[model samples]
Target: MKLEAIPRLSLGYLPTPIEKMERLSAELGITLSVKRDDFTGFGGGGNKVRKLEYLMADAVAQGVKVLITTGGHQSNHARMTAAAARKYGMKPILVLRGNRPDLYQGNLLLDHLFGAEIDFLDPDAYFTEINPRMAHHAAEAEARDEKAYIIPLGGASALGAMGYVNAVKELSEQYAAAGTPAPRYLVAPVGSGGTLAGLHIGCSLYWPETEVVGIAVTGSAVPFSERIAVMANAGAELLDLEKRWTADDIRIENDYIGPGYSIPSDAGNAAIKLAGNREGMLLDPVYTGKAFAGIIGCVEKGSIEKGSSVLFIHCGGSPALFPYAGLLTSDLAG
Candidate 1:
């Protein structure tokens, strides 16, 4: 069960650059760098592309003709999934939360441009309705004699998490090349927990001693840290790795969410502006912005000690910025 033995498509640019954020590091009194997964370079470049490489390989193996997945209206995952499906010559069907808006912008616009079939459900219907809707799409595909593959929410399944486990391995090599020690902490945004799950396992096996912290962008009744532990173990099983994770092993910061999911938080917007103005990097409101805000919050609270080396995973969602133009412009002006 070697990771290399697993089937994966070459969908994203590998080993996205790791750049030191000197200004932010000095400002925060900690050494800070970013793993630029935002530059993954496929389907508009995001962390989802890594997960899709494995998922798409599975779909192709199963002779899938239609790919189905669920996400919010501005879901970066949905946008990337659409692109991956098209690249593999499979049809993509997205079941998104919320009613259709009069204007299609941001990732929604890209989803449409990718020529995906989309269905919008009421916001309250998301949890209860998404699975059934995806199943319905599958049944319809069956009626047409075309196979549909349903990807889980955020592509959080064990198979897809392999992408980040491999990423940790890549990071290890990069650290060695740059002659830097393993980072004191690795931070990332957690929406569905798949990426964090993979990183936990990856850090355990490839870069020991580096703690991983996930910043939750969306609140969930089901404790995502516990859920992500189970997922990491499942991925470990897939890779035949000896490391086993538990809820205690996973650390998630949930305070920075500000409001509900998809709605930009004041702190998140400020963090977005800070990153853009300081590092010339764009961070979306949904994920990376809140995650960076968490980093700032943690530093202010002394949770992350001064002079510690921290690396943030810039999981791409900058296109999501387009949809929040009004809010962001107001922040910029004020």
Candidate 2:
């Protein structure tokens, strides 16, 4: 499936390195490494960089003068896509979900800094609801004779998923070059499901030996499983891959989502603190923290084999820390 066949501008720092987390591994009694997708060379570094590259490339190719996207108030995708849009000289319109923050912070701050137009929502509108607003805003921009483009939330489309598919190709080469063993399990926080689906498809096609495990940072496995399958199938088709994976091929664990999306969890806070103090790794409360807690819990419950090499994909969100300062305070241990 020649991943580069699709249009993508150079945005993210390609092939974000995989670093071994020796300190955290010793503390947890497992061989642990982190795929630093957070440093993927996007806006402040994140998994979103890869997706935005393809999305904006399409926008530019179509002569888009305005780039419109939707997400939560603190969406990494929106922030990065806005940056990409600016780089291409196109204005960005962010249809933000929910109430605007009392204080602009994190991704929201960056969005404003990038001069992306802010369209606030009902503090509870789903992406399905947020999307049409984006289209309406696009129409409004078009009425002014400006070309508009809509890049959906999380950039979960088939083309964007190809970024991770390309990532696996990069990983496979890195493993071969470094003479490292393939991980027994690949773990990541699943939100929009595109990243995990890409991992599932990429690993199945290339690194067949590794098992892909997605810890739901939000949402339930029942729905995410379907989304993952659809994405993987679509991504596979995008790549012209012959083999398609079924539901049996995907493994998702939603046991660690605490109080829903973007909400804080005690376990998540603890996990973030543990990683920070023990491994000198910073993880945000929403995504990576909860996902890490899930990994720790799974290991404790024997859901993950004791001696297997477990690789955790730090999908990034460290900037969300501003709003949840209290939870992170006094939580770290030496």
Mind giving the per-residue lDDT tens digits that candidate 1 earns over 1-334? 9889999999999989999999999899999999999999999999998999999999999999999999999899999999998988999999999999999999999999999999999999789888889999999999999999999989999999999988999999999998999999999999999999989988988888998999999998789989999999999899888888878888999999888899999999999999999999999999999999999999999998899999999999999999899998984584
Per-candidate TM-scores read 0.98, 0.95
Supply every candidate's count of residue pairs whose N, Cα or C atoms clash at under 3 angstroms: 0, 3
Candidate 2 Cα outliers beyond 4 Å, as residue runs: 220-222, 330-334
In TM-score terms, candidate 2 sits at: 0.95
lDDT of 2 by residue, 228-256 (tens): 88889998888788768777767888788
> Which candidate wins on lDDT?
1
Score candidate 1 by lDDT.
0.94
- Global lDDT of each candidate: 0.94, 0.83
lDDT of 2 at 56: 77
Residue 190, candidate 2: how far off, in angstroms?
Answer: 0.6
